[model samples]
Target: MTQYPHSPENPMCQHQPVCPSAEATDREAARIIACFPEQGWSLLCNGVIVFEDTGELLPDGSSIAPHRGPARHALAA
Candidate 1:
């Protein structure tokens, strides 16, 4: 089984390394693209849904899930 770089056990958010330390405000104060806390997910500008589980639902209706590894990781490897 493959593991994502920023899984729960790893605890290092690739998008925001300092997410734990940072203060978060509500949508009224912040401009949010989209969020689904219950599903641990959010949508990107181009209609991609990025999940905390390291999965992604692309704008083209394609999926890029975690464990398959991020594109950058594959390229680097």
Candidate 2:
């Protein structure tokens, strides 16, 4: 498995406000911190914040992008 940098050594959040998720990872936590206004919505850790959420960044970010599928036709032949 790909070892992410932000994987917590201990099963606890190392930030001011404790994180409830035990499954949280290092990169994942950093991404979430980036969204914090006080934190300037960006954690420039070992990984780069290519995006505020998802894509080049980690899988799950602050807000998830909606699915983009083909539009359905109202008038059927």
Candidate 3:
């Protein structure tokens, strides 16, 4: 449990990396984007990739599909 005096609502997250570090996260993200399921990816007009699920822009121009959903629909224009 957090012992600092920070607010409980925004308590400092104590979870540390168990396996996937930032580099691993990037690699995994790239792999997912490269072979994303049909619903997870959007090809922008300029050829950039945008993720559909959480709207977090993929670092390498695509996104890592969220884990639980069926996948996202095509990105909105």
Candidate 4:
């Protein structure tokens, strides 16, 4: 696993409302510190890499599988 210069308990986010910690359930909501549209992924302030498909790579090297909710079906007339 890769080690980050800052730990989750001591993140170095500068946002008005600091980003969520990598271990938080809503960690994916952290601000995007870096993005690579061509690569379909972005790095969050909390040290997580989120893919366009909703999958994630946490700072500790554990992966969170894509968790997109079920598609909504259209109502029949």
Candidate 5:
């Protein structure tokens, strides 16, 4: 079995209020431990890697596809 980087008992967050867990829906809110804008990716404290396009790779090696919100259209007068 593959070993995940983060777990409930070993959450890697060190922030004051504590960031969300890797299993949480809001896991992307975790603090960024490392970032590489040139590579278009960032590593979060909860052991997740997020990309510039909003795609994600969870600690367990599962992937979350890019989830950008719909673009806003200007209101017609």
Candidate 6:
């Protein structure tokens, strides 16, 4: 349960928006302001920009990384 500094009390949500605040300076950091329609809350934070749709942050789980098998990326020379 590693928590990011800018994240809110709870990072439990499916849809988190990309921060468009003064704090966010670049597209790399990906700071976002998310609005939880279900829980009725909002959060401001910076994280890995997994997916950005039309400059808006979609749900967190919207872009899940594909699971990798036992294969390794490193090549033994």
Highest TM-score against the true fold, candidate: 5
Q: Write the per-residue lDDT of candidate 5 for residues 1-77, one digit (tens) a residue.
A: 54444445437865657788888888888899999999999999989999999999988999999998875653332
What lDDT score goes with residue 19 in model 5? 84
RMSD of each: 15.3, 10.8, 13.9, 6.2, 6.8, 12.2
Query: What ordering of candidates by TM-score runs from best to worst?
Result: 5, 4, 1, 3, 2, 6
Q: Which candidate is the best by lDDT?
A: 5
Worst lDDT run of 10 residues, candidate 5, spans 1-10
Where model 1 places Cα greater than 4 Å from the true spot, the runs are: 1-32, 67-77
Q: Which of the two, 1 or 4, has more TM-score?
A: 4
Report the Cα lDDT for candidate 3: 0.37
Q: Can you list the residue pairs that collide in candidate 3?
A: none
Tell me the whole-model lDDT of each prediction, alpha carbons only: 0.47, 0.37, 0.37, 0.82, 0.83, 0.37
- Inter-residue clash pairs, candidate 4: none
Q: Write the per-residue lDDT of candidate 1 for residues 4-72, one digit (tens) a residue.
A: 365352233333332221122211222236788997987543344567876666545767656445578
Candidate 4 lDDT over 1-77, as tens digits, reads 54445544637665656678888888987889899999999999888999999999998999999988765663332
Off by over 4 Å in 4: 1-10, 71-77
- Model 6 whole-model lDDT (C-alpha atoms): 0.37
TM-score of 6: 0.18
Candidate 6, 27: how far from true, in Å?
Answer: 5.9
| Alpha-carbon shift of residue 15 in model 2 (angstroms) | 4.2
**Cα deviation of 50 in candidate 1 (Å)?**
0.6
- TM-score per prediction, in order, is 0.42, 0.21, 0.22, 0.75, 0.76, 0.18
Model 1: ten consecutive residues of lowest lDDT: 21-30
Task: List clash counts for every candidate, in order.
Answer: 0, 4, 0, 0, 0, 7
